[model samples]
Target chain A: MTAALGQSARSVLACGEVRTCLLPSFQALDGRAAAQLLRLRADEHVRVSERPTMYALSPEVLTGVDCRLPTSNGSKVRAVGTVIARAALTEGRLLQSTAYFSAPAAGPDTRRPWGQYLVRPGLVEPFGKLPQQATVEGVLRGAGRGELDLGTIAEGLLTQLRRHALLDRRVPFKSRPTHLRWVARRQPEGERASLTNFTVAEGGLRTMELRLPEDVPAAAAAGLCEDLALHDWLLTTVQQMLDNSRIGAADGPSVVEALHPVVVHLLHLWMPRAHVDAALGHLWDVLEEKPGFSRQWEKLSRRIRDRLALQAVTMPHQAFSPR
Target chain B: MLIFAASDKGGTGRSVTSANLAYHRALAGDDVCYLDFDFGSPTAVAVFDVADAREAAEDRGLHAYLIGEVSEPERIDVWAKTEHQVLRDPPPGCGRLVLMPGDVSGGEFATTDDNLRRCVDLLMKLYHEFDLVIVDLSAGRSYAVDMALEATAQPEMSELTARWLVFHRWTRQHVAAAASLVFGRRGIVAGGVHRGHDEEALRGAIRFVRAAVPDPESPLWSQVSPTQSAWMRKTDGDLKQLASTAGIGYSQVLGSVPLEPVLQWREQLITDEDVLDSQIANQETWTALSRLAARLTDDKYWEEA
Candidate 1:
């Protein structure tokens, strides 16, 4: 299928935005409820898996866009096509929705019929020659005014899922959501996919760049980015919890109370590359090597355990001792 | 949490005071998003000192987003975009302060089903992202107020917590007008109930904010003659009795902003520089606004009276 997509017209660039947040429910959803929440289409099926971790992936939905593509050089290039979006659930504890589109190098100058664009699920065709480098830089920076806004589309889907009646609308703790924007440029047919750069910016924004072979589908790229985003969110959120816990400044029970939610809802959600294709899973190596995602995670995990254990030892003495 | 700021009449300091409350909340490490829903005349851009946002939001603001003219409203990071020296360099550990300005040419328009849905969607999205979403509605019972009421009454928004802050100046006429705006026929309570809001729950969430209150005991008024001071005290007592009779008594009041020459002369956020360094704005005004910001989510202040 991916080969068929490549045969139609090799995509020069693939870019997407992923929004990761806590499912606004007090209790974590079971497998069945996860599927029901991620059912984006009435006719399509929501894939569910439980072996590695409880995860649900929704069918793709398309949004048509015809606007000026964001470019760094200020050159205006009109594009018109459908942007595909999908939602996923991890252990029913975290909810993520991604909006992405693939674009070829160039297309005819004139606009095409909406029906023609609808057939190709996630392909956006530029009206002229695509400025590959400029477009990649523009996407990494983010959409400007009157430019194609992937964040709105991604947020629209997230809002829809959060409003579903299945959710109880109760969050165990208050934490900010994270937005990860990723761009992948096409490499040669046989070259291995590589992760180029990853940047952590202010206000919970993360950007990543990748180079992938022509045979690997954009869907695989989206899956790989989603896995990376999920793990990044876990690390960011847990680190925040520990920082705000005020371990040395605040009292023992108070710090324990603050870290309670991390242990209950987030500590077990560190499985990386669980759903990415085998070809793209190696991208995780780049993150694991320098920053050592697992190493920092293990450190946080142990700190939380140590704090909880200290609380366990101090609870009885404090409760029964004379004041 | 969502907070709707409304006033029965203009010049009540509704917009400037609520903007200050938003500033105070953000300074205290809570991510806050302030929406300029005053569709007729948007002044938050000037208040927050984000002049660049004014030009960019002329065509794509909350009005454009609600009417479907744009995909998303323009957001100005107050810390990064503000021209004010103090606001430009936010203190460490401060949370994000975002402003969603209203369209320059936008005006009052009746709320339709589509507009209400979009409003709810925007609020829900902000709720999940920010800690506090402060929507500054146009004064009186306008379309903005109506839309906020109708949107919060929807089934999907039932689980979310929404509060109302009614601002009024401290005077006989202003107090009476503010009470009528919330309790009279076609008032917020009546209008909210007509649109499927539970009367008790809605009433529990409503609170009053008295702006520009004059205290006769303050040192600023020490030079006044004995006759004038006596008269001022008597009038203050009378207004208190009238407010209790009107059902917006002491318990119903959240906090009051003192009459500061700075806020009255130029409407802007009262930062620490304005209060301490420059000594232009009063310390009492700063304290009141901070207390009000903290009491916004305090259950003790919002409990049934």
Candidate 2:
């Protein structure tokens, strides 16, 4: 009986974190292909050359170069994006990147809503339900002192997005590109530096040529985009799983396991004061009758340490304690 | 593939270069994870400041995971912290480079030897979650070095597929010492250890390099680089000896990050000559570096039979 008590206690200790089945989040569904997708979401990297963005104002003062700041981590990464606007002396090249969604922006739909999307200019195709509003995420990567543009990766992304029916529109030609001004004298080989952003308009990719948001401290605000995406993806995934569970029967524990992070993120974003308590409370009750959920959660992560244990039961406001 | 950034010497830009390479690749749209396996220094925190990373034993870290102590993998706040360090305006969505920071607790560095095996398992798990894993070794090749090698080696211990050695040296003596250390009596001389190079091929194949503190004002910094031309081309014998001696490949010989004076004095971080220039200048160096990074990406090289 003593040994049995020890085993049970040890099991309880191991069962601190939640264990739910890894269910497919509906947010990733294209609503077309039902193929099981090994969804590998990618983060973009745009290295802004350390060179200053050059402004023309006409050819006289056009001698200066445009460059963004360094990373706060003391890295040499530069920002890259579509040139949203330009002011010879103000915003040299307003580079911006955007993402698109297919659902209505209501309580964060099943599809993860990236605050914005990399939509094609002038073309809002049917992407399920979310609106095709593209907003440039954070500067994913700063250009190293060594990287060069052999291939217009930006254009390639736009083109690929177009082929995938992901683009909103195209920009026009006669693209009078605004450029980064340079040092007084020009050097040879490898030192030839210049960069500019272009807008994806109805015609083709074109420079915004006006009303550009000046450098948004790319390095300082990096990863702002991915975190939001991750949050959205998780919540939408959780919501979808919850929706799906209403139809075909689903394993209680497994569904909760993959979705716990999503729900947690949602609580953190939408209702932080009670997210953990609420989640843990609901889970404790939901899982109390289902030993399988607790057992499986404990088994899968018997060795994992350092996370707050989920309270087995909900508590009144005064009773709900923080770990 | 696992790219081990090691140097017998300290402060050789191991962490910085590792971080930048991963950052650049992620910008190319590849998934990358940077592991601060430099448990000894644990500088990724001071350097990158992963806000969520505990510089102590308070929470889950590389330490707990290696000892089989962690219940779940630590969720580093890349977006809130180092992720911003990678991009200018924190790329709106997710980022390609993810960081697996080392334990901040200085005591964690005194890890037991066998723990490396567990660490490799953890790294492998992370690898499946990322396209590339960059390990910033503790200045010297500690147990972490052995773990990296074994992790990438063949089943029978013939060679490592995802293996590449970056030797950072400034002066001739440092360069020569780097070559010797990696090619000492019990060094890379253990021939046919891998399929790449032999002793004779490795003599001059040592990847001699200086830290990346560029003094744009200097003549070397101002001119067309990569055209800096080798001080002297290695003869076939010299090349063979270096390659064979070091047991590396010509391709695995990731070149150098030029010694920028700006880096020498400030040694803060790499940016442009000034913020004025655009179009990341100097093509050949980054290209060569990129090629080296690309090699570390192929899984066929590291997986055991």
Candidate 3:
């Protein structure tokens, strides 16, 4: 971490990838087990809070990557630095792993010592002048072969956590994992933070481009994106589940079978901006106006509940049958 | 449920047959994932008719994932990506069919602790997302087989159900080699036991699939002379006796595919169009594959004998 003055002195581009999936347990974990499950480093401590919700976040770990940056226009810019990764468990049900790094406007022509990179936890410096526009677009487009891949680093950390001995590797339901790639362009001081775009692509990939004012740390932007990613994943996953159910096209029992888990595990995870920083919380308003994430979520959750209610009214005995 | 397909020798149609089984499961409304673990020569892409995916996953395949070069292996949705006309449009209620191809140039390598862990992680992830996970291992007692054995024996996988399908051709040498690969001193049972699996449980979890078996009663052989037919019957009886004596009897056999020219030449999925419309593949071949796919998770079929 840089000094307080240095944090806002220069313009930095921050990018990250977050993977969200079910915790792979028959039941949601408690605070203690959640902490134990996310204890990635032996010497570090896992922060757990139960006030707002059962949340346990692991200490940040670093993965060193020295490779070429992915550019939209094929501008090859080499970078050398560490990528910080961390895991978080929300309400002991949904697990997320985020790997992110910030890059300054420019750096020395020659590579610095490894220790120098380690001290600056999540800062990746370009060899020469950094083309802010190309790098941000590249990250949103995804890295090419031999380029620095934030998704790979994030997935590696998630894989490590999913294989922890503390987990039983049993999931309550079947749902595909989702990846959200995000890039935040730092704005001048005193400017308002705004979300530029949120695009949902095929193959469970979602990209977010944002403009954040100075004084809000890159980590906070990462947090806002993570929150957005988690909720978007929930929406995407639940929608897919319903679509696969073939509600009117299929039988009532099958539709209920498909929508049952969303009611049990994910219905309560709709607290958007609950974990995002106060300053960045306003940025969600941009999305609230156009696509309306909360609006879509409320509608989806209502459909699930209404289906259950309708099933109960029609077939009471089969509605609550053991799953 | 996880199903691993292995063979003691190559050219036994192990990869093709397993890919067909995955296709059948998906047709039956079960999300199926076919993992190409044949590191020496990955060919599931050819069987699934997803040729473009092979080049796309050159460096991000299972090899890269297991060796820690990449985080998650590249997955190709077969229904959406297959070039074959019949497989392009999925039937209603048909589940997803995904193929995780191996590196185009990856060769067999020694299994390390990290590799085994990655294998277990991949299997677990697939088990949670898909209804059936079919991992086609490299033929013979290669590192793929070793890694599969070790990964399934881990404690995290204890509660999950896994079964092994050893594929072989219908021949004396192939039968003997397949049996020895499962029951011999250095076979799967022994290897699993050495790697902390229960011997009886491991033995019960394995079943054999005989490919390219020529049925003597078929109409195609009706033109043969009586003497030739009698000799073929005698030879088939002799092979069955040999199998029983070698400990891979009828009870251990899941199903056998009739020698069909389509499977031999195409090495692709036998869609219903091939049988009902095109009349290119034999009906018996389709029936055999359907039975094999059904028996994969049928507890009655896998019961200890």
lDDT per residue (tens digit) for residues A230-312 in model 1? 98999898887666415444565676667778988999888989999999999899899979898999999999898777777
Query: If the candidates were sorted by their DockQ against the true structure, best first, what order would they fall in?
Result: 3, 1, 2
By lDDT, rank the candidates, best first.
1, 3, 2
Query: For candidate 3 chain A, which ten residues in a row score worst on lDDT?
Result: A1-10
* CAPRI tier of model 1: acceptable
Chain A TM per candidate, in order of listing: 0.94, 0.19, 0.93
User: What's the TM for chain B in candidate 2?
Assistant: 0.67
Q: Report the C-alpha lDDT of model 3 over B216-247, residue by residue, as the tens digit.
A: 99997999999999999999999999999988
Tell me the lDDT of model 3 at A312: 83
> Candidate 1: misplaced stretches above 4 Å?
A1-8, A110-119, A245-249, A310-323, B53-58
Q: Cα miss at A31, model 1 (Å)?
A: 1.2
Give the CA lDDT, 0 to 100, for residue A228 in model 2: 21
lDDT, candidate 1, equals 0.89
Cα deviation in Å at residue A119, candidate 2? Answer: 60
The candidate that wins on TM-score is 3
> What would you estimate as the lDDT of candidate 3?
0.88
- Model 3 / residue B68 / CA error / Å: 3.0
Winner on TM-score (1 vs 3): 3
Task: Name the better of 2 and 3 by DockQ.
Answer: 3
For all predicted structures, in order, the TM-scores are 0.92, 0.41, 0.93
Model 3 docking grade: acceptable
